[model samples]
Target chain A: MTIDASMRDALLGAVPSLRAFAISLSGNVDRADDLVQETLVRALSHIDSFQPGTNLNAWLFTILRNLFHSEYRKRRREVEDADGVYAARLSTQPEQGARLDLEDFKTALARLPPDQREVLLLVGASGFSYEEAAEICQCAVGTIKSRVNRARTRLAQLLAVESVDDLGPDDQTRAALQATG
Target chain B: MAQKRAREVAEDVVPGHVPPAPPRLDRNAQARLGEQLRAMYDDLLQQPIPDRFIDLLKDLDDIEKGKSTGKGTTG
Candidate 1:
């Protein structure tokens, strides 16, 4: 079906966030771009199936996620670099401390199981509610919550975070930790 | 009262009656992790999207129009 102008515009707007999700999911930019391109093509082709005025982002995310599970997951496992190669290749900003911490976090995130990682990105980083994430993942809301909880716990373990107090003197970090804790 | 007291004592003597405390994550550590995750996500978002994607979208649009106009169809 032909994509209308407004739908096309909306799809364009979702690209950046979609790319971010793809990157986090795939851990490789080139692969992520391919996934984004695939998602777009599929989205455009199936535009008619999309119910108008609903949550387009969620719908798009579901499509991308299904594609990841069906195709990308197996291919990614075969060539997955366990040594932080792709993450190291990422461009870093001038703020060395924050950049280093972000790198560490990304490494930790990569270590998580795909299921946990997807939930973490959806509910934690992507700002989707439990219900929304559950819908996207095709699981129960409780499952999403548990996955997020496990993802956080595993990330903390992987990062060797002994205690919240040991996270240094960043108050915002402290507050965020407390909320999660 | 004597029988109730005996049952209470038996319950106390049962093995594995008390549960262990849940492991306490350092709040600061969790917050730091959360903050770092947010930063990473934000950084990912800031990365420039490749031009190929935009070009692909345009191509798809053209293809759709082409189909409607009875031009050579491209999938």
Candidate 2:
């Protein structure tokens, strides 16, 4: 669709965060990125519907989530919903230094139930609040809260972390900041 | 009695209580965790964006300006 300069800027600006959200949702870099591009297209076409003062990130995230769910529905019968399958296979061959640890975390994260992982990434890693996450997930606030809590618990358990507070400025943190910032 | 017992279970599982001092994630641990999270995200963020998407946007911008003619790619 025909887009304005401001709209273009906003879409471009939203790209990294959108891509990161897509990746976190899909767990495959290529798929995540394609989702981002699709989100951009959809957002651009429907830009007029976007309220100017409202949150652009939330809007973009909602679009990405809808796209993901639709894609999931389309592919559910054909493909396994195996989370982080790509990362797991990659790490098996061997990796060095922090790369190995990062892969370990990815695999653990991938193994998390999609609902839990989605809530964790949306709230914990992506910095969306409970309400915003609820909106994105189309669930009750209580549900979102429980999911986040549960996801954090699961991630901690998987990683052998004693607590969610144990999350630190590791490679994942840097990547998130780099993508979002 | 059941309600009270459920509440008690919930309290025990609250994130900070299980690990102790979760709010104050130790600096070193925070650093490492952040590193892992970032690494995973980096792969996604660094993936090459298609040229067509940008070109599509540019064309749209031109069309919006009434300078370009014909339909632009929608999908």
Candidate 3:
């Protein structure tokens, strides 16, 4: 099926967020890019299967997730970089505590099992609702919720975070936290 | 140390006895973690899309347009 301009435009719009999810999932920029490229190609080829007027981002994400599991996961053992190689590559300006916190968060996130991490990223970071994340992960909504809860708990334990105050002083972070709290 | 503590906690619980529930994050703590998660995600979102990705999209567009037709063309 021919990919129309509007569909192409939507695919372009989704790239950044899709890349973000890929990096967070794979923890490698090069691998994430490959995954994004693969996802876009797969989505375009399967355009007929994609239902219009639904969440394109989620559809693209599902494609990426499936690709990661089926294709990338097998090759991971062969090409996996040492843990923290990608995290170390991030250029954080000196004395930037927020960036440091993000680095720490990434480390903790990488420690979670892929299943838990996927749920956390979808429900916690990417702002997908439980139902939406469940649909993407092909699991029950309750399973997604519980996985998110476990992921948060595991992250807090890993980071040694005792209180909300320990999360740093970013106003947006505080506001988002409070809203969810 | 955390792993050891977890192991200790597990060891202390008898088979038939329900141990006290593990400490759960309070609402405030949960919110804080959520905030941090969002912040990290936001930082990731700010990363520039590499030129290669843009180029790939263009290539896909071209192929879809029947400009360059081949089965094994993609890299």
| lDDT by candidate, in order shown | 0.75, 0.67, 0.75
Interface RMSD of each candidate, angstroms, one decimal: 7.4, 6.8, 6.4
The reply for model 2, stretches above 4 Å from the true place, is: A82-94, A163-181, B1-35, B46-50, B67-75
lDDT of 3 by residue, B3-61 (tens): 74454345444344443434677766676687778877887798887887778778877
- Highest DockQ scorer: 3
Candidate 3: CAPRI quality band = acceptable
Residues B35-70, model 2: lDDT tens digits = 566566666567665675677677777777665334
Model 3: per-residue Cα lDDT over A1-181, one tens digit each: 4577788888888998998898888787787899999998888778999988899999999999999898756777788766665455443324476577777877788888778898888877777788888789887655565567677788889988776555445555434432332
Give the CAPRI rating of model 1. incorrect
Q: Could you give me the TM-score of model 2 versus the true structure? A: 0.70
Which is the winner by DockQ between candidate 1 and candidate 3? 3
Candidate 3's C-alpha runs over 4 A off are A76-98, A164-181, B1-23, B62-75
Superposed by TM-score, candidate 1 places the C-alpha of residue B29 at a distance from the truth, in angstroms, of 3.0
Cα RMSD (Å) between model 1 and the true structure? Answer: 9.8
Residue B62 deviation, candidate 1, in Å? 4.1
Residue A177's lDDT in candidate 2:
25
TM-score of every model?
A: 0.74, 0.70, 0.74
